[model samples]
Target: MTIRLAILASGRGSNLQAILDAIAAGTLDARVVGVFSDRPDAQALQRVPEALRWSRTPKSFANRAAFDAALADAVAASAPDWVVCVGYMRILGAAFVQRFHGRVLNIHPSLLPKYKGLHTHQRALEAGDAWHGASVHFVVPELDAGAVIAQARIAVEPTDDADALAARVLTVEHPLLLHVLGLATAGRLAESAGHALVDGQRLYTPLPLPLNPT
Candidate 1:
């Protein structure tokens, strides 16, 4: 059975586009039932067909929980088997996370457990780290502190700025996101004994890619 999916986002959605492309190409067995955005002008919303009931309104809700409740309602209405958060900037409430539980997946633009918060590329470049990457993890209540599903790391280039590094990391992110989504859709991705398991094996931490000449 195909995994029914809802996507949430708050910005320009390169990750969202990657998922859509993967679905279109039959690499992932899923259906994007709904696309919801907290921002009215989020570019991700434009990718959906007009006939689909996509939403971009959140100002009407009174509070954060209320917003989450409404958001949850929107997602439930779609009846998705799982939800994927790609570039979704909102810190979802505990209630929301619990409601979805193992059904929610998130993509972060960092190696994770290291740069769990923000400014990842810039921070990596500034800190002079050897590797920079993106991660896919299950969404839990505590920040990015969730079981990691998969990660793809690229070596930090010698002459890299934030923009240059982000661009490079994105290349790995696109494929890695698709692979995770495909695994989830196939029910091959699961959390067992506090570890994220793909095909019954623990996911490796941050497989670093070799830096290329720019």
Candidate 2:
């Protein structure tokens, strides 16, 4: 059974592109039913067919909850089995989180529980962290505080700035996100009672990335 996937993105949509590439290459057995963005000008919209692309301005809404409600409605219309947030800058509301529940996934630039919010690479650099990477996790209501599915680690070079570090991390992120999605579709990855599970076993820690090359 092909998993029906919906992607919400804000920005360059590199991760979105990665998923599209994976589907095109027959690496992932899923179909992207919709690609949504809060920013009307988001480049991610370009990756999908004209009918699958959707965009709405956040400014039109009176408040955050109202905006999220509209966003949730848009996602619901697609009837996606899974909702993936890739470079989606907006913080989702509780309603939206509950709507998708365990089916909603996000790819954060940080290893997670480390830099939960934005400026992850800069913060890691300032903290003198030896390693930095990305994590694929469930999207809970409290920021990025959710059970991680998998992570990709990379050593931080001595002279690396935020941009340089982000570039390296992104290279791993593209493949890592696809790998996690593959697991989800294969029934090897899941969440139960708020805990992440792999092959019906509880996942105490997130699975490490590069399990297989993209």
Candidate 3:
């Protein structure tokens, strides 16, 4: 069965494009049912049919809860088995997370449990970390605190700056996300008891990225 996905994005949507490209190339057994964004002008909304695109500025709503409620309803309308958030900048509310609960996933630009919010590349560089990468994890209301599903690792070279590190991480994030989604589409992954489950077993740590070319 093809997994239906609802994408929530707030930026250029490069990862969103990756998913669409993978589907078109028959590398992924999934279909994007909708693409929603908090920024009305977000470029990601253009990747899908106009009817499948939903967007509105957060300021248009009375408050964050109202906005999240509305956003959740829009996403729910798509009936996706998974809600995938890529570069979605807004912090989701508890109510919205509870609505979807175990079915929402997000790809963060940091190794997670590390940089939970923005400026991840700079944080890793400042800390002199030898490694940094992206993580695909369940999205709880606590902002990247959910159990990680898997991650792609890239060495932080001695000469690397924030931009260079970020660019490199972006390359790996695509493949990492696709790999994790493959597990989801195959019915081998899920959020179980606040932990990540793969093939009905607990994921003790984020799985290393597969050896496929990125």
lDDT of 2: 0.90
lDDT of 2 by residue, 62-118 (tens): 988898998899899999989999999988888999999899999999988999999
Highest TM-score scorer? 3
Please report, as a residue range, the 10-residue window in candidate 1 with the lowest summed lDDT.
205-214
User: Candidate 1, TM-score vs. the true structure?
Assistant: 0.91
TM-score sort, best first: 3, 2, 1
Best by lDDT: 3
Candidate number with the higher TM-score (2 or 3): 3
- Those runs of model 3 whose alpha carbons end farther than 4 Å from true positions after fitting are 210-214
Instruction: Report the error of model 2 at residue 7, Å.
Output: 0.2
Candidate 3 structure quality by residue, lDDT tens digits, 1-214: 8999999999999999999999999999999999999988899998888999999889998999999999999999999999999999998999988999999999999988999999999999999998899999998989899999999888888889999899999999999999999999899998888999999999999899753332
Q: Give TM-scores for every candidate, taking all chains together and pairing residue i with residue i.
A: 0.91, 0.96, 0.97
Which residue ranges in model 2 land beyond 4 Å of their true spot?
A: 210-214
CA lDDT, candidate 1, residue 177: 83
lDDT against the true structure, per candidate, is 0.81, 0.90, 0.93
